[model samples]
Target: MTELSHEGERLQKVLAAAGVASRRVSEQLIAAGRVTVNGVVVTELGSRVDPLVDKVAVDGSAVQLDPDKRYVMLNKPTGVLSSMSDERGRPDLRAFTAEYPERLFNVGRLDSDTSGLLLLTNDGELAHVLAHPSFGVTKTYIATVTGTATPATMRRLEAGLELDDGPIAADRARVVGEPSRGRSIVEVTLHSGRNRIVRRMLDAVGLPVVELVRRQFGPLHLGTLGVGRTRDLTRVELGQLLTLSREPGRPRSGIGAPDAAGTAMDDDESDSE
Candidate 1:
């Protein structure tokens, strides 16, 4: 076991300050062997860690020790640009960021005419991993299209299709319900970060999107959040996202250790728009 130096803050104190728990409970968790620092379980309550450098986990979930890092989820409304600022003075995220002191930016993007989940954060590393096409984090969308999307169509989406940009396919796709009137609701999930990828994919499948809304991004979901409102991410949501942001095979250790287990909802509402 590596000895903890006295140079950094005590592990329990860091955990408590990170909103994991009260210092006393943090101490209890540490002593109970529920906490690990960089893959090694740390049972010593007095063990110290640099919040900026040392990775800490509780019960297998990565913890965010940096207090200044903010993760926000916004249910963006249609016609709002994904950018913090629009050069043409169009509706943008300034209305949302103006509510927080943090200079946050969107993790990826939502089309100006499309709406649903949008993540805004000041954590550059996380934002980069999520927004970069190479990282391949999946996003789920509920799109209202022109006609009923058959199982064959969904299979075609899953099987793959060619776009003007390149070949692409959904990680998963399905028809949400029986077609109502002239429209059908479809749910599509894909990891490509290509611009307007969802819209393009649906068009290629002969189901032009009439309305599109992203219901999920990685582990975060829109979940009954009203359109145009923003809220801070729950501890569980943050932990899951931080875990996703890490490179493959990094320790799945924890923070966000609540007094009780935290629950996150999976929103699959087809009518998210």
Candidate 2:
């Protein structure tokens, strides 16, 4: 049992407010030795914690105590720019974010033509690390390309290719099915954050992309979320992302200037796709 300070809200009450469980169930969870405060086992009932200050976890997964933080996943549709606002007056993410009271900004970016999972959040720390190319968060895409993707092409993609910007390689690549009607579906996974990297890599391998959709980002997946729709991240998904953001070798600071919505934008205008 951990000692509680005289100040702050009750531990179970905080957990309940965080939507972890009801106040009764939260007390039961604490009594079961499944909760921790500041990395210490905190089984004592009636323990107090500053929701804004103390780090809390249940079953080794961090709990999001601050209510101000919001994590949203949007299945961005094609023809929409990843930016919240586009100077050219093109369709952008403003329509998706309009419902959320918290000012949310995209974590990274996707090209106007590519579509799928896009993360919008007000959590600057997680956004900074995930969007930073140095951290190397993996993204998976399903692309329909103009040519048949043979095993040789898959091998070449995995083996790597030299692009105009630099040398790049897919962490994983494979054909989803046999080619038909002059096009094939190929899945590629890479940690690179370069602009239009998937399309460029496939083109280098002689498979020019006709259509592309991101299937996954880090631990979050597009799942069944429809295009042009958005949903809040589940507690488990958010926990996984937070863990990834704090992994070893993550930079403590330095991404770029925060936009109006408080997201860290990379110095390079086109680093994300």
Candidate 3:
């Protein structure tokens, strides 16, 4: 067994960089004695290892440094779970991503009922940063509500609403077009990632959401990506996202807003109850 060396990276970090898990989870695995370094079980959180020289294995499976990182965007369809697998064996992204060799997880979640752009990647650090609320990464959604949005309601949405969980507010909210009869299209933007936040916020204001679709996340926009399809983010798109995640409160440009007519209801899939 190789002795802990100051020159090498920490064991948890090495595990995270190897895509085993996030740094915190990796520490738990180490504490559980599931990780072995140089054929010796390492249960210490402070242990270090040289990736090039030390053989690391988790659950007796050798961990290899994954050099080919993937960043993919999936137009998540309604009725499909956001998770990689469902305990009840319901549909999930696994069916869509089965062909890809690299194991990837969603950066943030979109409820099974909602659909839009969802990012998947094997880069744990980037995923952590993007998902953290402190980063202030903006998410844009177009909601089809059952009632027309009045100017007063728009003001209230911007000011903030007291949901069951806590106080929440949208950064921006606007009516997409003239309300026809009872239904209206609303555009909302906010940095909060609370579960079903968009739906909850509208519900707080008496406007129940009929359909919701996330059009943009940070600097990446779901431009013309058909439902149930997945594609790689462009190099420029990935670079901008990384920059946005690293530096919070930095102003980003050219994040296109959702078209007024292209609301979630436009999709062919039926909304889940």
Candidate 4:
């Protein structure tokens, strides 16, 4: 792009800006012989693009800057895997997107078995920032545990538990709801993006998270949005998120953790890795 100056820019940046894939992922698409410039395979990372004149294609569809970016929040039900596509032919988010005009990918993730709030977007840069651990987006979840969590256990969790990866700590946890009568419900909130951190955290303290549901992430909440449905975020909502991205007080980890479990929707966490 620097070389082009008054002419074409590099292809990878253009694709990333177009909400296709991350720059790294775009490079893979280019190298795998999936991308072409002006109908010619341009596998070279140095391939430049003249957006005004040259056409880029991936899998035969022309890639260009979409006029409008889509950012949606969905109450994802269980069964959908966290992937753009599934090789095993399992059902995915595409089923809920029949009316969508542009292709969008999930922002964070909801594992195949879990269900709850999921963000889908065509803005790769925003996705990159939002999903980055450094941003420390707090996620609130209601987890069904095998047994009641005692004060000592809660204190241990808040202070930090010794996990294989490291001492896993939560910002908050408390049980204040009813579910199935005898069993206690707890709500937990944390900012880290460790693999199955919520489930793992509960497991280490002798409380197994039987069912995990993410009710909130950062500035967004799983309000009245029904399961399997979605809606776009307002501009102001997006502005708040952007503002959060610029804040420093929000630690990279432990930014938000609620201590309790109840009244939260399940979510797919398979994509967290």
Candidate 5:
């Protein structure tokens, strides 16, 4: 019998962290005599191995540790649920991230009817910081509202409105473009992650939203990413996100400064429930 190393992580945890399988399933694999460490079969559940140095394998196949974490930006298309899988077989982020070997989950959610700038990651700690409201991660959205957005309506949104859950207010709200025939495009930014908060806030102020899209989250931007497409964030981009997560109070603007007409960029589009 090989002596288990006290300094290294448990074998099952290393396997699960590498995205091989869940911890329970990994234990089963070990009990079945399929797991080997440094060429020795390790059926003992308490067996530990240095992931960086150990030659871990399953059924003669070497298992490499995926030490580097992944952060992905997905331009979510409407009608796809913001989940890894669905019990009712609905389309989800998995369909787009099927090629990635890592077990990734959405950092936050976008309603099935709403879409844009959804993030997926395997880094749980970073995901938690981004999703938590205390971190003050701001999200910016451009909404197409049914009613003409006069200055009073913008004031109402910025001042605050009562919702079924609680009071919500926009960090900023301004007209994005010229209102045409009672329809106007408005840009709003806030930190609330309430379900359908954007749509509900507009409705509360008597400006029913016809469409909405998140253009920015924290320091990340959607930036012309085509709908239904996904891409990995660059090292620099990932570093910036980490830095922002550490300093929660830092302010983040949309793609650019508000133009002379006070219009923000119409980066993407979506319909809401």
Candidate 6:
């Protein structure tokens, strides 16, 4: 765990800046008596703090500032939801986190049944910024379809299809390697994180997706990473990812951004849970 910031600030303010959550959420922790300064529960709304030297605990654990951020890349397995703890008690990414001492959360979600590269981190603000829809950190996937999707299918995907809700499209769609008999391995890269957008798009065209495995997200790629295995994010990789837009208080600008009526990032963004 990193040391708490010694900088002059309120305990709650430091926690929020450390990415524990937003400032408003931090206040709630204080109200619930979850925050403590120097070993005493602090219910005061305006308690001052010095993260650098004072010990602050939230729910009995220290909230420290880590000068060096930690980033993890995991080849998430199918059937486990993307969460810190699962009420259903089903298997999750926590299986490989024994060595990680700091509290962590998913960078983005992968569907319970979709297996692919997943990011986990202790830095709250980085996760929030990366998960923000405006970033559109493009992701790539290799999907097996139920039926043959010829050059025409490729064009259809490129042209984008209309769904019951709205139009869905792929940023780049190409056949991987040579198409096998009755099966075509296709590589799809998209910036929009819509719910099952790939499957839905093909389904609408009568080429339902059978198996989907993500190969890349932003600058991170699965490559030969074995399924269910986890790895550390290289400094270079993390640096590249940080270049993504983290525009605050507004949705990302583009056709990929959801409609005016929409509330959250589109559907494809979730593959884990």
Q: Give the number of the best model, judged by TM-score.
A: 2
Candidate 2 lands at a TM-score of 0.90
Model 2, residue pairs in steric clash: none
> In candidate 1, what are the lDDT values of residues 36-134, reduced to their tens digit?
887789998779899998888889888999999999999999988776655578887889889899877776667778899988887766665565546
Off by over 4 Å in 2: 1-3, 254-257, 261-263, 266-273
43: Cα error in model 6, Å: 46
TM-score of 3: 0.67
Give the total clashing residue pairs for model 6.
15
Between prediction 5 and prediction 6, the one with superior lDDT is 5
Error of 5 at 147 (Å): 1.0
RMSD of 6: 12.6
Q: Which ranges in model 4 have alpha carbons more than 4 Å from their true place?
A: 1-67, 178-180, 247-268, 271-273
**Per-model TM-score on C-alpha atoms:** 0.88, 0.90, 0.67, 0.65, 0.66, 0.67
Put the candidates in lDDT order, highest first.
Answer: 2, 1, 3, 5, 4, 6
Model 5: residues >4 Å from true position, as ranges? 1-67, 248-273
Per-candidate Cα lDDT values, in order, are 0.80, 0.85, 0.75, 0.69, 0.75, 0.68
Q: Per-residue alpha-carbon lDDT of model 4 for 1-273, expressed as tens digits?
A: 123334567788888886668999999998888887655777877877876456566655555444466778888887776566665787777776667886677766677767788887665555666776666678888888888777777788889988898877899987756546446678888887777788888888878877777889788888889988889876545545645653444334432211121001123254542
Instruction: Compose the digit string of candidate 2's lDDT tens values, residues 1-273.
Output: 678799999999999999999999999999999999877899888799999888788988888899999999999899987777766788888999999999888888888788899899887777888887688888899999998889899999999899899898889999999899999999999988777888889989889999999989999999999989999999999888876775568876765435773335541223243
User: Of the candidates numbered 4 and 5, which has the greater TM-score value?
Assistant: 5
- Count of backbone collisions within predicted model 1: 5
The local distance difference test score of model 3 is 0.75
Give the Å shift of residue 132 in candidate 2: 2.1
Question: Could you give candidate 3's per-residue lDDT for residues 1-273 as a string of tens digits?
Answer: 346677788999998997778999999999998988866899988888877566677776666544576889999998887767665887777877787898777776777888998888776556666665555678889999999798789899999998888999999999898888799999999988676778888989989998889899888999999999999877567656654554535333322222221111111122232
lDDT of 4 at 171: 90
Cα RMSD for candidates in order: 7.5, 2.6, 13.5, 13.5, 14.7, 12.6
lDDT of 5 at 123: 63
